[model samples]
Target: MTNAAVDDAMLAMREIFPETPLQLNEHLSRRFGADIWLKREDLSPVRSYKIRGAFNFLRKAIATAGSGRVFVCASAGNHAQGFAFVCRHFEVHGVVFMPVTTPQQKIDKTRMFGGEFITIRLVGDIFDQCYAAARTYVEETGGMLVPPFDHADIIEGQATVAAEIAAQLPEGVTPDLVIMPVGGGGLSSGMTGYLGPRLGDDAFLMVEPQGAPSLKQSLIAGHAVTLAKVDNFVDGAAVARIGELNFAALSRFPESQVMAVPENAICVTITEMLNIEGVVLEPAGALSLTALASLDPAAVRGKTVVAVVSGGNFDFERLPDVKERAMRFAGLKKYFILRLAQRPGALRDFLNLLGDEDDIARFEYLKKSARNFGSILIGIETARPENFAALLQRFETAGLGYEDITDNEILANLII
Candidate 1:
């Protein structure tokens, strides 16, 4: 709410950790032709901005309440780890409720951070359900509930990220733009709160995962909108609804200022950041950078831009899936269901139709005993997206009966 409050939180945070770097990114600068800087919150001890809010909330709570109050929270990933880390820092007992479906990597990380200072309860399958259980637990036990993004203290704490960006910029010069990823809007709103009065509204660009456009939808509807469902691929930023407090801070911005990045587009950014920039970013962390590709290059060509690289808690096991999604999104990979005549050489004919650049990634045969044709589930990976068009033309010439199921959700889920 106040710059003084955010400033105080930033000062308090210095006791536990050093400032995360605001590095001038040469690669992005050159690629976008903009003076691009990255606020590497990913380099935080807990590898995310979540710690700032969690720590600030607990500090204020303890100061106002007492050291003996049991703190409780619910998070699918990053926030839980942050809460656990903060609990260990203060040597206070904490209870973390996470969805049963949460990745094992996150669960392990939270435990590693909390050690004996916290107890983890695996609750319902999704975040909302898990959050409900956490609320119930807090009510029954009379424990202090630490909300991830909804509270005032949490917003003030997260605002330190903006302060760091402000202080770390060369000569304290203002960036023409500051891009931030929005989930429940904690970090985005917090940063906006800090920057709005200082830089005005025009300096910010907010990004959200396309699969979870809570902030975008809310801004459109003039109220916080709850999504019926969200694709949890961008786990840290796929919130179903923007937090009320967070939305209040962010409501002034027009919906056009916020961009929705596709899940696979985020994967491409994640891969690029890791391979090109030597920066490991989770899907949510890559949201802001991914949205840059959607912007008109002419607009950002000579401007100074700062994009917050929010987190780096990526699991190596998910890298393969990330690549797969990236390839699919690029149109270099596709899935199809082909029906071939039962006669011999039918398979060979279909195979010969594929282009030289086309590689068969998957071939599963489904025999229909009562039908004259056998069903083939085929996945093709090509060197370029255009190669797929040529290959499909060849299929038409061969008179192959097939259906492209790459974008068909039901078929993709059932077969692919």
Candidate 2:
């Protein structure tokens, strides 16, 4: 369907929920030296843009099947909640299949939104297994499967965000750039389809997690290529492959338009938005904003830009891990394995090497090889990132042997 049709769909959607705000962000604008506006999909009723697709799909399905039809979906995050919310709104039966390992917080929120209208099935160990089971259930029960992405109806629904963006821009306000985060590519495809031809000379930047650059790889390879493995740090956006339909819509854009944001760097943005701006953003939600940091200031200076903050379904339990990742990304923290002499004065001597701003956050003796030496895992936090260089210089001067494992994923996975 054409983007105009998608905009019409969005207009119809306003009967259900108001268009999310498109507000200029002063803090980000000031920092980036640009006129920055945030398309606040996070403020949607389901606290995400997923509802747009979910509602659109359900609206179409209900017209065909009538009320009381069963709808099924497989998701462990925002999409599931969005589907649940739409089911409750339509007063239809819904079945949500989530991984058995899905966090309690997400499952609870999904249940809360669905209430009596939805049933939760915790099946399989991960999303792929749950997805297969959901498909099977849909086939067996003759229910409609509301895919998270990879479908035309879902793309048309998600395009509503772009429609709202077009309507919300004030007179004489045309965006010089639009930055969006790509998951399975629903939002990106929809938005690009709506805005690509219209925004002549204006740039569209697509951001994806570094570990899951499905769209980027696909564009480079001239077709979709499923990643062998994907890091699930940005759980919302970490799809191993870009959706086929979504990729077709996105294929027009040049590969250079896409940017890969590192998982660690995203953590930095998430923490900064939370601690400094008091805005809690999921990793995917923070993707576009994080990419802004690396953007050429000259290209964006004084130019209007819109960033889609896609979702805010963050679990508070992961906050500590987020903070830790942010600190490491910013170079203000380091982890080291120190080979320390097991003599009586060894600990005190090691402590004396620390700079004034350096503080030991973690100190554990992993093993003692003999009477003379011990392997110690030490994590140090410093006020300034540069302090680490000085601290490492001190270690060198002191002739202390150490292995810095701050960036070693293998060691971190095992020990930290």
State every prediction's TM-score relative to the real structure.
0.96, 0.97
lDDT of 2 by residue, 95-194 (tens): 9999999999999999999999999999999999999999999899888899999898889999999889988999888898999999899999888888
Lowest-lDDT window of 10 residues in candidate 2?
194-203
TM-score of 1: 0.96
* Root-mean-square deviation of candidate 1: 1.5
Off by over 4 Å in 1: none
Q: Scored by CA lDDT, what does every candidate get?
A: 0.91, 0.92
Best by TM-score: 2
Q: Report the lDDT tens digits of candidate 1 across residue range 244-349.
A: 9899888999999999988988888888888887999988889889988779999899999999999989999999989988888889899998888999888888
Best by lDDT: 2
lDDT of 1: 0.91
Looking at model 1, how many pairs of residues clash? 0
